[model samples]
Every structure is written in structure tokens, then in C-alpha cells.
Target: MRPKLVLFGDSITEASFSDGGWGASLAHLFARKADVILRGYSGYNTRWAVKILDKAMAGIGGDAESPAAVTVFFGANDASLPDQRCGFQHVPLEEYRENLRSIHAYFKKKWPSAAVIFIAPPPIDEEARIKYPSGQAERTNEAAGKFAKACIAVAKELSTPVIDTWSKMQEIPNWRKSTLSDGLHFTTLGNKVLFYQVVNILIDLGLSEEKLPADLPYFYEVDPNDPSKTFG
Candidate 1:
């Protein structure tokens, strides 16, 4: 039987803008190799993600030996400031770290043998802050990077693997300009790039096989006025 992999995350993971966001692309890439379940929600933080995972595993009676692999991505909403536009508040770095530790402990207890991969959120476009005028975009960006580092540290403590999407994103000079049109969320190409990067990381960790397709499918475009088309 193929391994069951669960992707639990936020908007980026939820693919709020397009149909085949990175998670869908990952599912396709790992088709037949594993059963990939996309369990992501928009505007969720680590605190909520832990609850969601608890709800997901409520009735699944499998222990560590028969546990499922879980990949977690958060910190986007957690780093946001308290504003009506963003509809989320900033969580302190220490609080965020505690939440992450809780999540790590939860999965470790439920699925001791299952591999857990922590994925850090991508960098935000400082220029995009002009649209919403957060003024704290740079600070938020720094905090997000710190959150990723915290996750890596937690994973190290737990002996789990981590996929540093943040660092990988930083290496791309045009990532912000080309990947994000609004300084948040990814364009089609951006999601594709993330998909491949994630798949490669999973392969390197021996959690997944390297069977990615050469040419991945793009999201279908329709009316320009439709926000769903632009975001989902």
C-alpha cells in the first residue's frame, strides 16, 4: 500500500487563488506513489492548524507504526498585524513557537514513526505594503523569517526534517516581482516553482519518490474581472 501524506497549512497551501495550487500539483506529482490529502484553510495560523489536525485524526485508529506523514505550513497569518483588512492579528514570536511545539508534539504522539515536515512561509514583498499601508511589512517579513528558523529549531529538537521554503525563495532575485503580483499569494508560475521545490525536498528526505512530471499543468484562466480566477 502507498503511504498516506497529509498537507496541513494556510492560504498558500489552500490554493485560495487557483485550482491546482502547490498542493494539487504535489498530489499530481506524487500520484500513485502516495495518497496525498490536501487539508489546508485560508487565513489560518499555527494555533488553528493544530486544532484542525486534532479533528482530522479523531477517528483514525492507527498508531505510530501505521501513521500518516504530515507536512505543516503556517506563519503567514500569524505574522500579520491586527487590522480589519487582514482580519488577523500578530502573534508574539514566543507564542508562535509554543504553538509550533504543540503541533510537533501532537503529531509525534499520534504518529511517532510518521515523518513530519515543517515548511516555512515565503517572504513578503516589501513594496506591496504600500497598497495596504501596513508600515510593518518589513518587520513582519523579519518575523516570518524568524518563525521559519524557530520551526527549524523545533524540528531539530524533535528530530524531524524541515523544508526551508523561505531560504529557497530568497535565492530567487525576481521571486517577489515575478511570483507575487500583490506582494502576497503566488502567481501560477510561482505556485509551480514552489511545487517542484517541495517535491524535491520530499524526495531528498526519502519521504517521497522523485517522479515529478517535466511539464506541469497551469491553472485555467477565465474572466479577468473574476477575483476567484485571480486568487484561486
Candidate 2:
């Protein structure tokens, strides 16, 4: 069986395979290499996500031939303020950290051979969120940083690689304008940024462009006369 790449998180991850989403970009990049699994919980925080982690990983069949890579990108909802608007999704800082650690432990036990990456929560544009038609002042840049740091700590503790999207996005000029859409969601450009960031991290971890070979034979390798001859 082919190896897998799992993306576990919330809305950002659920919509990742959508148009111009980071997950979609990876799908194209890893076309035949591995099956990209999206385990996105639209409005879940780590607390809720962990409850369903077992189900999400059930198909992985932890073993030597299990998933090749996994990215646990969460924290957006965890950083939500403990107010009516986002209280349901709010996971306290300490619990969030513990949740991450628990997730790492679960994966480590399940797929020990798989390389794991953690993605810190990205920043939120408070002003933009409030202006959003269906949004409230739930997430904030400050909380994002806090959770991002917490995520980084978990990665460091687990000896895994992490992508600090929160700080990285800020480095760019007019980042608010160019990096995010709808205050909480990513813009086209931001999606590209995430795709490349993930690519770079995978490469650094010894996963190359050709690491996951095309699932099917190259077009040229197929015989035009007897297409069946090309079936692997």
C-alpha cells in the first residue's frame, strides 16, 4: 500500500484541499507519492479534536507501511477567548499544551516511523474579524502568539519540526492585507506561503520532491499501442 500524509486540524485544514488551499497544493505536489489525508474539524479545538483522534487514525493501520508523514496543525480555536462567542471552542492554554502532547504520544505509539510536523497557529486580524459578517471578537493576534509558542514548545519536547506561521506572516510588509482573508482565513497568497513552508520543511526532513513517486506510471512509460501494458 502507498504511504500516507495526514493533515489534522480545524477549518484551516478542512478547507485546505479547497481551491488555492495549502492542502490542495500538496495534493498536486505529491500527486502519486502519497495519499493526503485531511482530518479537519471545522470548529474544533484540541479538546474536541482529541476526542476524535482515534477515529481519524483508525485507517492508518499503524505499522511499517503506515503514513510517511503527518502534520498536526491546530490551535486556532484553542486560542479563542473564553467568552460566549467562542467559549465552546476555547481550550485553556495548559490544556491545549497537554492536548498537543497527548496527540504526539498517540501518533508516536501508532506510527512510530512516520515523520511528524507541527504547525503553530497563525495570527488573527481582530479588526477584520469583527467586521466579518458572521464573525465576533473571538480570536486575537496576542492569543495566537501565545498558542503558537506553546505549539513550538510541544514540538521541541517531542523532537519534531514545527512551522511558526504566526511570526513568519508578520515579517512581511502589509501582512494583514496580503496574508489573510476574512480576518481568520487565509488568502490566496497566504495559502501559497503555507504550501511552500510545508514543502521546505518536508525537504529539510529528508523528504524530497521525488520522495513520493507518482502513484501511476509516467505517461511516457505507458505504451500507446497496449495501454494495459503500462499498468503497474
Candidate 3:
């Protein structure tokens, strides 16, 4: 069986299979080489993720090799303003950090051989968020940055790789407009950026298509005149 690659996170991750989404891009890039599994929950925070981690991971890696890789992307909702409409999703900064640590620890305990990667929350655009239908002004770029830092710090302590989406996106010119669709969610361009970053890291971790063996015989090797030669 092909190895698995898991994506675990909140809303952004939930929508990652949409057309032109980063998760979909990863799935396509790893086709025939690995299985990309998504376990995203919309409007969830670290607090909630911790509650369901075991169940979410249940049945995975059973009687087979553990996932080759797993990406944990959360924090956007956790950074929500505690007094705002989305306050229910807010998690204290310190607790947020601890939650990340707990998550990494859990994964390592369950799948010590799996390569775990954390994805820091992307920068938020307050204006765009205000313009969004919810218009609750629930999050701010500054808060997101703080959460991102906490995420990176956790990754450092755990000695795991991380994709600093917050800083990376901001480095791009006009990222607010070009990368985000409603300040928080990614636009197609944003997806493209994340896709490349993810692919690059996976390559570095030796999970690239070139490095992984395809699951079945290559099409070219199949003899049309005598199918059993390759099959049998």
C-alpha cells in the first residue's frame, strides 16, 4: 500500500480540497506515491482539536506503515479576538502554545517514524475580514502573528519542521490582496503559493514524487500484446 500523508487543521484545511487548493495540489503531486488524508474541522480551535485528536487519528496506520508525513495547520481561529463574535474559538496564547506541543507529542507517540510538519497561521487582513459577511472583526494580523510565533516556537522545541505561512505570505508584495480571498481564506494565488512551499518541504524531507516509488507498474512497461508479462 502507498504511504499516507495527513492534513490536520481547521477551516482553511477543510477547504483545502477545493479546486486550486493547496491540499488538492499536494494530492495531485503525490498521486500513486502516497495517500493525502484530510481531517479538517471548520471553525475549530486548538482547544477543540485536542479533544478529538485520538479519534481523528484512529484507524490510520493500523496494520500498515504509519503516515509518511502529516501537516498540522491551525491557529487562525484560535487567534480570534476573545471579546469578538468569534470569541468562542479564542484560546489563550499560552494555552495555544501548549496545545501545539500536546499535538506534536501525540503524533510522535503514535507514529514515531512519521515526519510531522506544522503550518503557522497566515497573516490576516483586518479590512478584508471586516468586509466579509460575518464582518465581526474577529481576528487581526497582529494576533495571528503572535500565534504564528507560538507555533514556530513549539516546532522548535519539538525539533520538527514548520512552514511559517504568516511571515512567508507577508513577504510577498500586496499579499493581503493577492493571497487572501476574505482576509483569512486563501485565494487561488494563495493556494499556489502554499502548494509550492509544501511541495518544496516534502521534497526536502524525501517525500517527493521522484523519491517515492509508484504503487503499480509503470504504464510504459505494460505490454499491450501480452498483459500478463507485467501483471504476472
Candidate 4:
């Protein structure tokens, strides 16, 4: 049986397939090697996420060598300033730290030998993210960095891999305008960046052609007159 790859987090995760979608990129990369499962709960922070890990784990039962990877991406909402934009989801910094720790601990315990990777939330655009439609306002880059620090701490302690999206996005030119659609969500270009970043990581972690089953009969194996004859 093929192993599984799970993507877990909040809205960034829920919308992972939107536009060009990072999740879609992983799906194509894993192709026949694993099931890329999305377990994103829009607006959820690590506080809420820690509570839901068991439920998420229940959906996929895997031993050691299977389900090879799981990536945990979060923090945007938890870093929300208390006075601005959807404070309901904001978790205190200390709580956020512990929440992340709990999440990693649970994933490691539940899936004993599975490789767990963490993705720090990307920078937020305060200018474009003004409280719109209905909330207070703005998710600052400074705040997201703080949460990213917490995420990195968990990764270091557990020896898990982590992607510092918050910092990477900043390295790009005019990222606020080019990467995010609304200062919060990702644009298609941004998705490409994320796709490449994640796919490379998976590759480094052994998601190579050798590990995947042939997507289908290779073209060279095709019986032009009757390709079906070559299919299993």
C-alpha cells in the first residue's frame, strides 16, 4: 500500500487548493506514492488544532514506513493583534507556544516514526489586510514572526523539519503585492512558490520517482493500438 502525506492547519490550509494551491502541488508530486490528505480547519489556531489532532489522526491509520510525511502549517490567526481583526481566534503568545508543542508531541506519539514537518505562517500585509467585510483589522508581519519563532522552537526541540515561510516571503520583491491575494490569502504565484518549497522538501525527504508507483503505464510501455492491454 502507498504511504500517506497529510496537510494540517487553518484557512491557509483549507484554501490550499484555491487558485493554484500548494496542496495540489503536493498531490501531483506524491502522485502514486502517497495520499495527500488536507485536514485544514479555517480560522483555527494551534490552540484549537491541538485539540483536534486525535480526530485528524483517526482518519488515517498508518504504521511506520507508510504515510511517510505530515506537514503542520499554522499561526496566522493566533498572531492576530488582540484589538484587531477576528480576535476570537487569537491565542496568547505563551499559549501559542505550548499549543504548537502539544501538536508536535501528539503527532509524534500517534504516528511513532512518521516524519513531521512544520511550516511557519507567511508574513501578513497590514495595508491590504485592513479590517474588511466584518472584523477589526490587520495581521502584522511582526506578530507572525513571533509565532514563527515559537514554531521554530518546537522544530528544534523535536528535531522536526520546519519551513520558515514568513522569512522567505519577505526575501521576495514586493511580496505583499505579488504573493498574497488579499494581504492574507495566497495568489497563484505564491502557491507556486509554496509548491516548490514543499515539493523540494518532500524530495529531500525521499519522495522520489523511485518511491512512487508509476502514475500509469509509461508512454514507452504503451501499445499504441491498444494501451488498455498494458494497464493493470
Candidate 5:
């Protein structure tokens, strides 16, 4: 069976299977080499995610091969202001850090061989958030940056790879429109940037499309004189 790459995160991850999304990009690139599994939960914070992790992991099959890599992408919601409308989703910065550590520990215990990657949340566009009020707590780039830093800190402590989308996106000019869609989510270009970031690290972890072997032989490998030679 092909090895798997699982995406574990929140709304950003949940929508990653949509057209021009990062998840879709990975799935397309790894077509026959590996299975890219999506386990995204919209409007979820680390607290809620930690609670459901075991149940989510159960679907991978206890006896089956462990995933080659897993990405923990959250923090966007956790960065919500405690006093804002979306305050209910807010998880304290310290708790967020601890939760990330716990998540990394759980994965390592279950599959030591798997590469665990953490993705810091992207920067928020305050003006956009105001224009398109989605009932989510009013978030600011500064607040999100804090959570992103905490995420990086946890990844460093755990000695794992991390993608700091929050910082990277801002490097681009006019990032508010170039990268973010609703001030919180990703635009197509944003997805491309994220996809490239993920693919680069995955390549480093030996999980790239070029590194993994395809499951079956090519059509050219089959011989007309003996079809069984290829089938068998």
C-alpha cells in the first residue's frame, strides 16, 4: 500500500481540498506515490483538536502502516481576542503552546518514524476582517503573530519542522490581498505559497513525489507478448 501524508488542522486545512488549494496541490503531485489524507475541522482550536485527535487517528487503521508525514496547522482561531465575538474560540497563548507540545508527543508515541510538521498561522488582515465580518472574533496581525511565534517555539522544542506562514506571507507586498482571502483564510496565491512551503519541507523529509516510488509499473513496462509479466 502507498504511504500516507495526513493534514491535521482547522478551517484553512478543511478548505484545502477546494480548487487551487494547497491540499489539492499535494494530492495532485503525489498522485500514485502517496495518499494525502485530510482531517481538517472548521472553527476548531488546539483545545478541541487535542480532544478529538485519538478518534481522528483511529481511522488510519491500527495495524496499517503509519503515515510518512503529518502536518499540524492551527492557531488562527486560537489567536482570537478573549473579549471579542469569537473569544469562545480563543485558547490562551500558554495553553496553545502546551497543547502543541502534547500533540507532538502523542504523534511521536504513536508513530516515531513519522515526520511531524507544525505550521504557524498566517497573518490576519484587520481591514478585511472588518469588511467581511464572519462572526469570528475580530483578530489582528499582532495577535496572530504571537500565536505563530508560540507555534514555532513548540516546534523548536520538539525538534520538528515548522512552516511560518505568518512571517512568510508578510514578506510579499500588499499581502493582505495577495495572500489572504477573508483576512484569515488563503487566496489562490496564498495557497500556492503554502503548497510550495510544505512541498519543500516534505522533500527534505523524503516524502516528495520525486522521492517516493510509484505503486505500479508504467504501461510501457507491460509486454504485449506476455501481459502476465507485468500483471504478475
Candidate 6:
């Protein structure tokens, strides 16, 4: 039987581009060998992801023998909005780490045999600041990076694998050029690049095969007519 892999995250993972988001692209890439499930929601944070998992498993009869792998990405929205209301804006770094730990623990207990890969949110381009005009986007980018590093530290404690998408994205020269026009999401090409990185990590960990296609295309240049061509 084919293995089951779930991609969970926010809008970026939800990628509503014409060609579908990175999760859908990943599903296509592994279509021949595995069953990929996209469970992303727009504007979802780690807190919401935890709740979603609870809802999925409530009353369902499943066990480790039929376990499903999960890839989780959050921290963007958590750091994006200010905390005057929930006071999460003032949430300490230690608390953030605790949140991650709780999330990992919850999934591990529920699906003991499943592989859980933590995915860090990608870096935000400077252009995104204009959309909010509150400078929260820049803060979100910084906080997301910190959150990624914190997740890495947590993974070491739990012995789980991480994709490190945040750092990989920083290495891309003029990454802003590859983003969607909105400057908050990735273009079709951006998602393709992300897929390549993710697949590589999965293969290195023996969770997936290394036999990926070589001629995968990405949107390198911005095309105003194509909605999929825009990425932040």
C-alpha cells in the first residue's frame, strides 16, 4: 500500500494559484508512489492546525499501523497580527517554543508511527510591508525566522526532521523577484522551487524517493496576465 502524507499550513501552503499551491504540486510529484493529502487553510496558524488535527481524528478509528505522515507550517499569522487583543503580541519566545512542543507532542501521541516534518514559513519580501502599512509584515518575517530556529531546536529534542524552508528561501538571490505580485505568497514557480526543496529533504530522510522529474518548470518572469505568475 502507498504511504499517506499530509501537507498542512497556511495561505502559502494553500496556494490558490491557477496551477494549485505547492501542496497540490507535491501531490502530483508523488502521484506515482504515494498518496498525498493537502490539508492547508488560509490564514491558519499553529494553534489552528492543532485544532484541525483534533477535528480530523475525533471519533475516527485509526491506528499507528495505518498512520499518515504530516508536514506542518505555521508562525506567519501568529507573528503577523499584533497582540493587543489576545496579548499574543506580547507572547514571550519561550511561550512560542512551548506552543511548538505541545503541537509536536499532540501529533506524536496520536500517530506514534507517523513521520512529522516541521516546515518553517518562508521569508517575506520587503514589498509586503506596503499591504499592511503597519510594518507588521517585517516583524512577521523576523519572528517567523526566530520561530523556525526554535522549531529546529525542538526537533532536535524530539528527533523529528525539519524542512528549513526559511533558511533555504533566504539563499535565493532576489527572492522577491520570484514572489507573487502581492508580495505575500509564492508564484507557481516559487511553489515549484519549494516543492523541489521539500522533496529533497523527504528523500534524504528516507521518507520519499529521490527520483523526481528533472524538467520541472517555474515562473521565472512576472507575467501580468497570469495570476499564477505573481508571488511575494
Among these predictions, the greatest lDDT belongs to 5
**Higher-lDDT candidate among 3 and 6?**
3
**Candidate lDDT (C-alpha), each:** 0.70, 0.85, 0.91, 0.81, 0.92, 0.66
- Which regions of candidate 4 fall more than 4 Å away from where they truly are? 64-66, 132-136, 209-211, 223-232
Largest TM-score belongs to which candidate? 3
Tens digits of per-residue lDDT for model 5, 125-201: 98777633454438989999999999998898889999999999998789999999989999999999999999999
Clashes of 1: 3
Candidate 3 lDDT (Cα, 0 to 1): 0.91
Error of 4 at 2 (Å): 1.5
Q: Candidate 3: minimum summed lDDT over ten consecutive residues — where?
A: 128-137
TM-score of each: 0.77, 0.90, 0.94, 0.89, 0.93, 0.76
Q: Which residue pairs in candidate 5 collide?
A: 86-137
Ranking by lDDT: 5, 3, 2, 4, 1, 6
lDDT of 4 by residue, 109-140 (tens): 77877788899888888888775565445578
Error of 5 at 13 (Å): 0.4
Model 6 residue pairs with clashes:
83-89, 179-231, 179-232, 180-230, 180-231, 180-232, 181-230, 181-231, 183-232
Better of 3 and 6 by TM-score: 3
Q: State the lDDT of candidate 3 residue by residue for 1-232, as single tens digits.
A: 8989999999999999999999999899888788999999999999999999989988877535789888999999999999888889999999999999988888888888888999999999998777455666789999999999999999988889999999999988899999999999999989988888888889999988898999898889899999999988
Better of 2 and 4 by TM-score: 2
RMSD after Cα superposition, model 4 = 2.7
lDDT of 6 by residue, 22-135 (tens): 777767767666667666688776666666777754543367344457777776666654542323433356765677778788778877777788877676665555434343
Q: Which segments of model 5 are wrong by more than 4 Å? A: 131-137, 220-229
Consecutive 10-residue window with the lowest summed lDDT within model 2: 129-138
Q: Write the per-residue lDDT of candidate 2 for residues 1-232, one digit (tens) a residue.
A: 6667899888999989878999989988877676788888898899987888888777666586668888998999999888747778899999999999988887888888888889999888888867355566778899989999999988998889999999888876778879888777798888888889999998887676677566668888889999987773
Q: Write the per-residue lDDT of candidate 1 for residues 1-232, one digit (tens) a residue.
A: 5667777788887772366578777677666466677677887888777678768666554783344577888887787755535545566667778888888888877888777788877777766755444444532467668877877787788777777766777677687887765676777767777777777667776666554332323345445577565556
